[model samples]
Target: MSTEAEYVRIDDGVLEITLSTAAKGTSLDFAGVAAGTAALAELGADIGAVLLTGAGPNFCAGGDIRDFAAAQDRSAHLYQLADTLHIFVRALDSAPVPVVAAVHGWAAGAGMSLVCAADIAVGGPGTRLRPAYPGVGLSPDGGMSWTLPRLVGAAKAREILLTDAVLDAAEAQRLGILARLTENDEAVLDNARALARTLARGPRASYTSIRALLSRSATATLGEQLDAERDAIGAAAGSPTGREGVDAFLAKRAPDYSGLN
Candidate 1:
């Protein structure tokens, strides 16, 4: 069958999720939401890593305003949209494997939020991210309020949201929103793929555990976080991969993580 709102393909242990509505600049609607969520869930079933990107120059241009205009109550409509976005963001945040976003061109509003939700993000040097909510006479949604502050602190996040400023890849990197910045879209995808490969070959359980810990640590108290770390360590130590890692260190050889399954 032809791809739906977008396309999802898995190869070489990596799942590549692409936004396919290039004519619309990948603008999201309810159909896009359903398709994207299903694609991501399917990709997570077997893949060791996921790479999210767009098929055209723009990663995404945020919600399709035309769809928004069709709703009866704009406030309720926006809340529904935010709820849909939360489902997708939570899936990415809780995925068992690493997620890398390969950003190019414009990543605005919810698109930027998606990039932030990824475990690692690489952007093209020419890529631009805009907090476009205020510009459109709307407030931030799709976990932007939560993720942005964590990445750049409250002051900078407030400035971005209040002004709806567009940030270049270099500025995004400086603010800790982007993991790496490259000269072109291909380079950004290449770097993300390389990083995903490395993560895929590492201790999968340990990586998942650490991902959970770090994502939750932001709002946790120091003592609560310490307890979480202790619990996570104990759980990891009980895993077969952990034993293999210990044996490898003592034997002076690389761990056979393929046996983790």
Candidate 2:
């Protein structure tokens, strides 16, 4: 892989995906997006969690505006760009393990979308977010329209997107956008990595089921969700990990999940 593509690596059952490029901003161009897509596609059963971070002054300033400006056929160009980005976003969403993000500096445009997509986000005191699409005279993409509403509710999402409001770390945390807030930029990644490692040691299959159940609860009726939960709990109880957990509790010892996953 090229230097630009060396953005993913697995360590101790955690897949760490760094979003970076040689470009001016931390925003992903075609190369970075493609690398991310490939990395997520190659996730294996041994991988128990994912940690997403950005390199440079910002988490991600959004898509490549310079590339957008350089496009001869702007409409077609943006269409392809958004389509490719959605593929990576979908992979991130569907990954069986929990996903965490270390967000520092300005997370604008697509970067904001990513913060919304992460299952958990750790932000620093300097973290800020903006729906940069409106400022660029475009609508939201990369599932921002879908994910933002789920994170902050429809009315708040509408207001923020329509106004292109900038969200500071405290406000973002209050809105449930950032799960944790660090004292400084350096601590953001450390805390997120620690959280990812903790999650990596958990029951991976149970986490997958929990993710699916919560995602489905958004669109499913109460009755439908209840039924789904019933099935999931039943399956979990019958699994080896579940048995180990119960045995460990009864024996007053810690469960050994390392051998299972």
Candidate 3:
């Protein structure tokens, strides 16, 4: 699976998505979007977790500004580009397994959007995030407008994007953008990979249920959320994965979830 993938690799039940371009920087160009979409689509139920990272200093620098600048019809080109990028972004959002990101250096524009969509983001001292769209005379894409407010609240998301605020590692962690912080910038990716592997060894169905319930809670009334949770928990408790987890707990042994998910 890894050999056929242009920007993704699957190993030890974890899919690592390397968002890197030939220039050694992460950019949401046509190739990157297409590669990411295909990689995510092909994973199916083969993996238990997805890890997102970059190949260079920055996680993602944003869109391919050079391509956008060179386009004859900038409006039409940008519209199509953004629309396609959204498909990849939505795949990350709706992935059955957990999505983790190793956010280092700069996560600007679309990069920041990806960080927002991640279930868990690991960063380091040098990590910085910015909503760079306004600087390019554009609005948010990749569901940034929707995910940011959920992470940092509506007012803060508004201020951050409108003012183009740059969030350093500490600030981003405090604001819940980053779920974990490593010792330094270089440790971010390694730590995130370890976390993804750890999650891959757990109950995949439970994780999916948790992700779905939390996402639904964003707009669900208290009663609605309670009902949803009840249904999810009931289903999980009756699943094969759930039975193995319980048996392992009672026997004080490690659960083998390898074939369960």
Candidate that scores best on TM-score? 2
* Alpha-carbon runs more than 4 Å astray in model 3: 1-4, 22-24
Q: What lDDT tens digits, residue by residue, belong to model 2 across residues 121-168?
A: 999999999998889999999899999999999999999999999999
Q: lDDT of each structure?
A: 0.80, 0.88, 0.87
Query: What TM-score, over all chains together, does every model reach?
Result: 0.90, 0.96, 0.95
Better of 1 and 3 by TM-score: 3
Question: Which is the better candidate, 1 or 2, if ranked by TM-score?
Answer: 2
RMSD of each: 2.3, 1.4, 2.1
Across 34-125, the per-residue lDDT of candidate 3 in tens digits comes to 77678788776768899988777789888888888999999999899788888998888788899999998889998899899999999999
CA lDDT for candidate 1: 0.80
List the lowest-lDDT window of 10 residues for candidate 1. Answer: 1-10
Instruction: Tell me the tens digit of each residue's lDDT in model 1 across 208-233.
Output: 88888998888899999999999999
Off by over 4 Å in 2: none
- Highest-lDDT candidate: 2
Which pairs clash in the backbone of model 2? none
